[model samples]
Target: MSKDPEDRLTVGEVSRRTGVAISALHYYESLGLIASERTTGNQRRYPRYMLRRISLILVAKRLGISLTEVQHVFDTLPLDKLPTAHDWRRLSRLWHTQLEAKKREIEQLERELMGCIGCGCLSMKSCRLLNVDDELAELGPGPRRLDAAQAA
Candidate 1:
């Protein structure tokens, strides 16, 4: 919010402003999702712009996006300034397809979960009535029946 491009915030100030813990900020830095400069006294100081990145990370987290994915998208963003509305739009567009696929996967799993509730045994050998001598194994690992159902 400061007009000064040199405006910087201490870790505690950033934490208070963003409602993020200082440790989490450090973790984000460690993961390369965010960065900071060290003072001569060895304290971390973040540019005011990093608040936007942290906010974006929190939103992505709530949407079930991984930090790796966030970092991938963030690689395209400018680090010296707050991301514009257009930048945020682009980020959302990038994530839209991934989120949709994840939604469909969750829906399919929910449907299959109901079907499995009675048997509850997803074992290849024990679920002979459904798996029938592990024939599904030939297709590879995971819930082959569920995956097959989805394919259908």
Candidate 2:
């Protein structure tokens, strides 16, 4: 069966229009983040609507969202149509909440890090005042004091 040329885009065409590399488009397909059809000659042919999907993927990546997360969201949508503006707004709201929580955690870590630097010590474990005879060694690895404080 012949696909209407206007409704389908070649790999190169998609790359040119979306500014995503051909290899990255293939990688996205491999991850199920996008999909394409093979022409009778085995060339890749993407639906024209995939341009919008690629844009959404690029936007999500720029926001530091992992491909796995993008795939999870994409999996929830119908594969036959472009995502609507409502979909974009819903995702934006969800990501905003998540990013805000991450910002707060980073700010908290910054405060803790400043305290650690105040003593002019390079090693928290070896610091005379903080570790005191390697007492934290018994608590296991990592920033035990910070971990404990955060837990509390």
Tens digit per residue, CA lDDT, model 2, 1-152: 12677799899999999999999999999988778888889998999888888998998889888888888888987677777999888888877887898899789767666777757775767654566568888889899878989999
Top TM-score hit: 2
lDDT for position 47 in model 2 = 90
Residue 29, model 1, lDDT = 92
Global lDDT of each candidate = 0.84, 0.83
After superposing candidate 1 on the true structure, give the runs of residues whose Cα lies further than 4 Å from its correct spot: 1-6, 119-136, 139-152
Q: What are the TM-scores, per candidate, against the unseen true structure? A: 0.74, 0.77
- 1-152, model 1: which lDDT tens digit per residue? 34453688999999999999999999999988888877789988888889989999999999899999998988888666789999999999878989999999888767656667778776765554466557877898787777878999
- Candidate 2 error regions (>4 Å): 1-3, 122-152
